[model samples]
Structures are given as structure tokens and as C-alpha cells.
Target: MVLAHAEHSGPRVLNIGEVLAQLSDDFPTMTASKIRFLEEKGLITPNRTPAGYRQYSENDVERLRFVLSLQRDQYLPLKVIKDYLDAIDRGERPENLPPGVKVSPRIVSDEFAAEMTGRVRALTEEQLRTESGASVPLLQSLLSFGLIQHSNGRFDEHALQVAKACVQLESHGLEPRHLRPFQAAAEREFGLVERAVSPLSSRRDAASQARAAEAAREISELCLTLHRALVQDRIARMDS
Candidate 1:
């Protein structure tokens, strides 16, 4: 969602004032810093005026809403959300629901949850490095972007995509520094997610807490997917 003039045709610029006006109601805590944070995370990129002011399009606003909604309602970590968005950017529509949940318009059904395990893709470090052309620094960059995680020296399918994205960026002369903004954005997103999950974490039963955690993640994934769909649809209309 970087704020480039659409490579094809579309509404390509939106100012901060406009974004705030549009989003202020649905997202009460919405702020310039938060929007900028999303931009830093590569979640939404607003165009710059001749004077270097930020401009966000309708698409950007919707994307931000989806991102914030997920953080507030679903409690997903930024990294997981980014993977879903990245997949959409790559022209793939993720199942969106978590493991063993059915995909619906508004909620995930239990029938669908059972199938989640089959959809997961687990990759080792060597394969990630090999196929995605990700160097240690690149992996570190992905970590900063909140696009992947490192646990005991391994990564998941999300890591593979981040590695691939790095490879894609290399051709444009971009390196890790180009991705530092993502780290900053991630801090904001983490705060949002944490606040949302606090109630569940404080609860008594372990089972309820676990379910709450899963639901939070699933909800965020759904929002990200929905937002991507909306953006693409709007862009397609513009192109047409």
C-alpha cells in the first residue's frame, strides 16, 4: 500500500486531514502518529505533496481501518497481519481464518478451524535462506518489519514471504535501511494488539484465555483480508 502513483490507474493521493476526518469516528484513537506508524510498517503509504506532506487515498484509509480494527478487535501481532497483506499483494487470497475455523462473511466457524492445520506451511531456516534469497541481515530486516519471527533459529511460512520480499526489493537497490520504518510501525501495532488482548490475558480459565487468543488472531487476519479485498476492488475500478 505504499503511496506511489498507482502503477496502473486509481485515486493515488490523500492528505492527513482527510484521512483523519474519514477515520475519526470508527477509530476514536486514530492519530497522525498512528497512521504514520502504519505507513512506516508498509501497511499504508500516503503520497507526498511537493512540500513533503503526507497524502492518503481512500484505499489507504480503508487499509488503515482494517489494520486498526484487527489490532483492536482480533489482537493479532503485526507480523501475522503483514503476512496476510503481503499475500494479497502477491495476488493470493489467503483462507484468512485460523486453524480449524470456517470462513464466513463476519465470523469464523468451528468447522473451518479443524482444517487449519493442513493449511499451515512450516519451513526451516536453510530452505528459507535458499529459496527466498534471504541473508541474515535480510532476515533481521524482516524481523524489524514485523513480517516474520525468529524462534529458536527457525521461521514459519511468513518468514519465507518476507525473505522473498527482500529478494524482490534488492532489484530496486533497496536494503534493510529501507525497511526500518516497519520496525517503528510495529511498535504502534503491538501496543494496539496488546491493549485488545489484555482482558483475555487477565481472565481466570486457561481454556477461555487460549480460545480468546486464537479468536483475536483470527479476527485480525479476517480484517486484513477484507481490507486488501476492498483496496484491490477499488483499484480495479479505477483501472477500469
Candidate 2:
């Protein structure tokens, strides 16, 4: 069975050193760079100190545990992992287990959810453009390259964030064409997710559809988290 856990409150936040000491045994390959990568990819948002150092809370550590466990045991790509996380963030807890994967139950107290309640806000494309200051052509370019997408003819909060980032990247001379690799990579990840969810999704029963959706959402978030960690490590090497 795949090991999974949930975040709970803690008395104090932990620094990188403490985080490393705590996680080193379970996730042998976990490095500071990967943690930073998760931060960068918005998977785990750690608070920054006055000195610009990261301070990860207990919540952050549990998130890392879930991420590492999924990558090591499930061999899921980052995209799927991310989708899973996103679903949770959106308050959708999916059936996590699929064929060949058995996830243990995650335990969390009522207090656990107190700090993390609310609806995930979604926005229209026009609203996204208005708020993000993204130009029409830039939005078009992102769509053309498959970087940012419209869901149900509207952009979700995640899509808005991606569009905003793409706008910033454009200022640095990385155009949407340069981001096509990311799109291709996402498609490949989607392919893997489809294979995993198709069997359940194809069943005629009504419950099967819900299960498939849940499975798809969870795996997708898991893959995204994994992707961020792997990419963070590679990017970190450049400074080393």
C-alpha cells in the first residue's frame, strides 16, 4: 500500500536545517533545492524570514512527505501529483487508489481543517486578463502553446496564476514559444493520468465516474508536486 499522511498543527515553524533533519530518514534524496523548488512552483508556500530564508511550517513538511512518498512509491510524474494537490486545495478529496495503487487512510483532526477552509476562487478570462495585466496577444500565445488554458470557457485561479507568471516571463524575453516544452511535458503527463483513470472512468456505473474523477484529480496534483521537486533540483545545480 502507498503511504500517505496529512498535515496537522505544530507549536513552532521549522527552518531548513530542522526540516532536513526530520525528513532525511524517510526521504533520503530530499534536498534543500527540491524544497525550494516546491516553493517556487507554488506547491508548498513557506514563509520567508527577515533575512530571506525560508521557514517551513509543519503543514509544509507533511506536504513534502506526501509528495516524496508519491514519487518514490507510485512513480507518478509531477503533473499528476500536482493535480491531486490542486484538487485537495479546491476542497475535492478524491478516491486516491487505482489499480496497482493502494493508499492508506489519512488521518486529520477537526482542528486540522480549521486553518484551511474556504472556496477556491475562479475567474473569467477577461477578469484574469484585467487583473494580471496580460495582453490579448500574450493570452493568445499562451493558449496556442498550451501553457494556460480556459476551463469551461473560463480560467480558474490556477490558470490566472499561470497567465500572470507567463506575462512576467515574457518581460524576461522567454516567449510562449519557448514555453512549448512545458506544454508538451504536461500532455505527456496527462497521457499517463488518462491511462490510470480510464478503466474506472469507462465503467457504466454512476459511482465509477465519481471515483474516476477523484482518482484523476488526486493523481494530477501529485504529479505536479513531484514535477516541481525534480525541476527544482535540476535548476539548483546551475548555482552550485
Candidate 3:
């Protein structure tokens, strides 16, 4: 088991496959690429062996369990979890962290939490259709344009904001039909990630491909998250 690098002398390190096999029963979606992506996101840093192979200790496994559980059960984004872990690493007492954030040196993981912003309210379908000219046909156009997507058969908060923008334009006789340009722009933006992650899809190995595909999804999700924040920030300036 890996302890905090600071807590004990370094011991034997497990390979990537071993790590997955050990945790797959619990985290079915855990993959080597997922592990690497977590590292890229600054969540966990496993030590490397002489040949540059990743060698995770008990601590790494425990941390992985914590992160995977949060993502699977709590629906948190990796960036949120990373921030929480970073705080505890610096000896900070995060208010949301489970009381007594301690792990056995031989055990590899512990649960924790970071401060989070609250949710934004989304406009309802009636608001979309009546105020924004967002009829079902218009909604489909937006989806075709890649400007909108369903969240459990409902439009997301960002879609509502975009729809609101359409409403604002409608006052001047511009309709949702006039927003196809936005959809085209979104397509181009999505294409950026698609091309960047194309190699992952080309790999023939099932496990390797699965992990890479997830990493790509996670990266795109992160981009969407940042994009949402930027859009909201810019909109906030309107009130100022």
C-alpha cells in the first residue's frame, strides 16, 4: 500500500494494469487513461519507476477511490475534486472535508471536499417558447446547429441563457432562425477537441481506447464548464 510520500519510505509500486484490476470491481470505469487524466488535472501524482512506468502506492489507490466515488456518486467534476485535494495537501482545513481527513499510511485514499459555488436557475420551457421564440422546431434547429443539447429531456441552464439571447433579439424582429451562425461557431469549437483527441479513437485496444475516449470526454466537459462560466461572467457585467 502506498502511504503519503512524506509518511513512509517508498515501497514497491504497482503497474497501471494492476491498479485497474484492483479497483475495477469498485470503479468499473476506472482506466489507465482516466488515471493519467486525473494526474493531468492535478488530482493525484503516482511515482514513476526507473523505466518511467507509473507505480502507484497504497495512498494513490485510496485517493483514486475517493475521486472515483465522488464522480460516480456525487456527480462532481474532476476539477472540483482536485481543488479540494490541493487544499488539504497544503495543510489547509477545508470546511467541507470530512472531519478528520486521515488515512492509514498503508491505505491509499481518503474523502474530502472543497468550497463550491451554487447552481444557477434555468428558464423553463414556457419561458423558452414564449419569451425566446424557442418552439420545438427552433429547439431542434439549435440542436442541429450544436448550440443546444438535452439534459434529461430538458434544456440546460446555458441553453436557457442562449435562448434568452434569442428572445432579446426577437424584440427587434430577429428570431431563433437568425441564430444558426452561433450553432456553426459551436460546431467549429467542438471540432477543435475532436481533432485533438482523434488518436485515442484510432487505438484498437478495448481498454486503451475506452480510457482515452473517457479522457477526451472529460477534457471536453471541462471546456464546456469553463465556457459556461465565461458566458455567465460576461452576462453579469450587463448589470454593472
By lDDT, the better pick of 1 and 2 is 2
Error of 1 at 210 (Å): 13
Candidate 2: stretches off by over 4 Å: 1-126, 146-159
**Which ten-residue region of model 2 has the weakest summed lDDT?**
102-111
For residues 216-236, what per-residue lDDT tens digits would candidate 1 score against the true structure?
666567656766898899999
Residue-wise C-alpha lDDT for candidate 3, range 101-140, written one tens digit per residue? 4433243223212112223234456656766666676666
Off by over 4 Å in 1: 1-12, 98-240
Best by TM-score: 2
lDDT of each: 0.62, 0.69, 0.63
Error of 2 at 131 (Å): 2.0
Candidate 2 Cα lDDT to native: 0.69
Please write out the lDDT profile of model 2 over residues 169-189, one tens digit for every residue.
999999999988887888899
